[model samples]
Target chain A: MNKINILDKVKSNVTNFFQPKGVFDKNFVKKPLIMYLIFGLLLLAIPFLQEQGYIQFYTMGVFGMIIIYTIVALGLNLLLGYSGLISLGTAGFIGFGAYGLPFFSNLLGLNFTGALIVTLLLSALIGALIGLFSLKVEGVYLAIATLFVGEIFLEIFRNVEWFTNGFSGVKFHYPHVILLFFQLRITVTSFILLVLSALIVIALGYIGFKKYKNKQKSKIEKKENRITKIKSRLLSIFKIALIILGLMLVLQIVLGEPLLTFVQSGNSITTTGFRGYLKLEEFDRNQTFRFISLILIASMFIIYNIVNSRTGRALMAMSRSEHAAQSMGISLMKYRLVAFITATVFATLAGTLYVSWFTSAYPDSWTLGFSLILIAVVVVGGYKSIFGMFLGALIIHGIPTFYLKEAFADINGLPFIFTGVLIIVVILFYPYGAIYLRHDIKRLYRYLKSKIIKFIHLIKQRIQKSNDSEVNEDE
Target chain B: MNKNTILEVKNLSMYFGGLKAVDDLSFEVFEKEIVGLIGPNGAGKTTVFNCITQFYKEDKGEIWFKNKDDEEINLNDIKVTKVINHGLVRTFQNIELVPDLSIIDNILIGAHNQFKSGILEHILTLPRARREEKELREKAHHVLEFLKLHYIKDMYVAGQPYGVLKKIEIARALMANPKMIILDEPAAGLNDVETDELAGLIRHIRDEFDITVILVEHDMGFVMDVCDRICAISFGKFLAMDTAEEIIKNKAVQEAYLGGDDFE
Candidate 1:
């Protein structure tokens, strides 16, 4: 009787444990902010961990590239996912940025900041021009137009030997970091810290502001007295300011030295009748990883915020029905321009970063194949999800170039075959992208778990019966 | 034109190749009135609506609209997107709500023009943008409440019942705060009960929102019941424009619907 009681108790305990509580619950595991922070911290530790010989430099480099691709994917996601614009000229914008950076730095003799600003402006102008075409054409025709534009850009890069150096490409000295009257050479670590710290500040500020607003709204809902409302608002503002200040202090402690050094350095030089002193930074692979990761995080946050905004809603509506969207007072041309410009700027930034990382800009690299891969990344990642696109980039670009090249070195076309198969599988099973795979996996796990529990219960019943028989025999 | 006339179409004609989808069709929509465009299948009721809204540019004729600012503007001179800015908006015959977006988000799209903040403000989540967004959300909630669709505020439009989807579409149009709304076949797929509910809702929208409603519906019962004025058409030509009772008794409308002596 005791044995039977024990078996029942065990079975009930197992069932109780699996009854959708604690970690088993979806809400508990789906805290986006917590997950993001953890992921961010992990990314921060990667460079240090690599330096300690825990991870190889090659691996870090590949990871860094993956982070860059994630930024590109996020940018593309803004267009493809939110705006419903399928662009095949992503490579063209990237090439323009890549080539434009060198042009600005070498010919215009501008610093990194100036070069980036100029490149972005030029890319926006070009993007706007391309956006105009979207007004006239859409879907497959727009795709073709973008493709043609990309090819034109490639041709310009290849033929303009004076600027792009033709097939040979243009190689220029790294742009210096200039501040006030000081110039300091930048290391990869400092650059990473600089970018990451800025992103952290923006993200935290935005989130903090949002939380404060929600609190204030709730307070208003409670019908708090006006005086009390004012007092609480001031108090909340003070608290937020203090928190932001504290965060800044912490970042300063971590990254203050590099910034100080950058400001204090008095490295001077004169070039071609120009007298300007600037910091020259040597960017290494690890810094590349850190920088790209920073960009990825920042872009992800921005895109997330945008999608939740009115502009995002308009773009989504436009995608579903142009006629309906127009009826809603959405200016199709304006929103399309915004989406196109944003995508172009992001691609341009990625291109500029790529050139800096490799210390070379290649026309051949920015081809139709590159653009197609980006499209595949957005599609396979689940066109609507930012994080999904990140994974999509890793799968589509990172895996083929890093892992497959190493694993199947003898197999000339293995990467292509593998990517095709993977894309097909993802499309077939998770048409939404791998982001939705979590739900499917959870469902599968639940089914298997229930079956296992039943099997265990059946075994326990058998054991209890056997024990009872033995007791009966002894008696 | 009457002092309250919000829209006037003069000899509006649209042609697809040699086929004239809408030819020499003219009508006027007055303030706070429900006008029905009734026609048989292939009579170009939708085409006429499209021409009025400038979805398809008429090869001939003028669309004159009295905008919210009290300016009489030629709608034909402007693009389709600008028509809504003039306080004129429309709903599709087939419901066109963004399937993936929540009902609130879908309605929020209609508030795009009302947003005071620009792209930069939205991207940075500036105070003004947040304030605008909050106000829009409140307005959307109010609309949903008014339409009795607050239950489905968070629900996606995908696979929703035809009645609910039609209501959502109208809800979206209402969110635009338009002076006039053009609903194409608002009760197309609804049953008798649903159609009656829709007719009541359409009247409520016109009265409560203080907007002119132009609807193209095939259901004679629905049209007669809801419409203040009925415009009957056949083969892209205006048959008659009169009160619902007068339209029901019109000989040309009867012939158009029941066939002429040639058929007998």
Candidate 2:
């Protein structure tokens, strides 16, 4: 009882320390803290839930779904938010990844790990080809062209049996990791995988926070110290690389038995079920299932990194004005292709994760409905805000699975009705998304401050003029 | 005088279906001379600049530029992208800088060719790309310092005045390290004092950089002050080309000006 209270108190204090100050406060919610705290809490809470037996069934399902959609959102953000390219073919790209996974993993005799990487590269190559057209046209034309491409991809997937095994779909199986005399099964259980990936998502969120804040600070400062600029950029990249390495190491350790014999019977132990054996009834034993979440998380990290880089800024510039971007001598096609390719890579990998988890792949797995949900997430979450998109994925994809599906089903049009309501509410009330509402409120406060400054300036000017008039009269 | 000419236009014409905007225009700027292109409103003064810059494809005739290593190249045959490589840079009549990009970034865009760093280097954030980026930034800083625009190095083009933006455009054009610069109405929006400052800047750029400057201006006062030689054109035909003093006294030049009737 005492231990639980102490833990609760520590959590509360940590939250208080990082929580944003009042909207009116000038130094409210430093980005780094906000980013770390939000994701950190989510990570901590997951393991805690597993201890209480309250984190089964849909927890893994919902988390897995969120990871998938988050990847999709990351890709779409590159298109709509960064590269100024509007795409309606997200479902098609995701379907490509899903369908491609089976061919590489089963038919080609490639392991699950090999198949995932191959799927990502293939999707990126194809996406770059399709995204090439964005250079020639823009607005409705580019949108329609991409939409057509998506439709064509779907048609190909549905008709082609050899590659995708037709409309029925193909099941996935794990391959053993060969290491000298010892054989290691690379299959990952759901609970351990989710926890490990949740930790990674948290770490990535931290890295993203550091990057975004550093960028914002540099922009505001203008006259940045040159050494600091070089240092910060290098440090930011180094930190990202370090975090990725750490996540990979953790995945490797957790995948092998006897991974953790030291931990007490606490929340972490309950969540991982790692006691030198696969005897934990509460957690999954399939190594592939565990790895799917981790792999998806890793893909999410790549997406986040791309979104935070200089190329990302170029994407944003292109999105705002293609003519201006081109006039400045930026290769419009190169950046557009990069954005599309990056986005497709994320969706493809996410689809791979989805397939690996369920041991199945199909053309209809990521459909128009799935694409619409991703678009909704991007719009409602806030376009261009990567962490916000992840948060949005959690709320939109996670909540619907846990609580809102019944309410959605009870309605006549089901999920579409909720989506419609969400759009109207978002567009009308919070046009910038829930994350930006805090920013907007802060902007309003700044506006009020500027007005006050202007008023004070006017008064000072009046006083000075009056004093000057009196001096002239006296003279 | 025609023997050492750096650029020569011959019978250049442009038409938009029925409207002959530029008809049979011809002129030449001598090597190292600061030349002025002057004309009444709608007399295709800027159209000639656009033609030379290859921003417009002429319907007729040829535009020639004397290249380094002494080769005569046809400007009309060259694409806009190749024009910069030919050591000719142009500033627009209206400033067009990327608003979201910083002033230094705007200048660096003009210096795109300076860094021969490959796409792989840019992507991997390799040492060469990093060093090249820093070098380009330093060059931009130096140019901005020379122009006295160092204070706004980090500022975007939006929220700046028309005059400052114009200077930014000039600074950007200079980044290409052109052998010649074509400036369109550099003193248009500036007041008398600012115009005087600009006059000095024009002469300084020409003398210090050893680059030929070709200017188009409706501000006759400025044209008379800064131009080493002046050319007056009317109806896409060259009326006069001489020292500013001689062009001011030329009968054809006077007639083209007063012939408009609207001019006093």
Q: Pick the candidate with the highest lDDT.
A: 1
* Candidate 1 residue lDDT tens string, A165-214: 89888775443432232334577887998999977776675665455445
| Winning candidate number (DockQ) | 1
lDDT of 2 by residue, A290-402 (tens): 44444444544555545433465456556655433443345666787888787788778777767666667777765566777788788888876767777678657666566
| Candidate 1 structure lDDT | 0.79
Report the lDDT tens digits of candidate 1 across residue range B1-264.
Answer: 569888899998888999988889888888888899988889998888888788787899998889989889999898887788888899998788889999898888888888889876666566568768867887788899898998879988887888989888888888887999998988889999999899888888878878999998878788889999999888899899999878767889889977753322
Q: Which one wins on TM-score?
A: 1
The window of 10 residues in a row where model 1 chain B has the poorest summed lDDT is B255-264
Location of the lowest summed lDDT over 10 successive residues in candidate 2 chain A: A177-186
TM-score of chain A of 2: 0.62
Badly placed stretches (over 4 Å) of model 1 are A1-37, A172-284, A410-416, A455-467, B11-26, B59-64, B69-74, B261-264
| Collision pairs in model 2 | A82-A315, A84-A319, A187-A287, A187-A288, A188-A287, A188-A288, A188-A290
As for model 2, its CA RMSD to the true structure in angstroms is 12.8
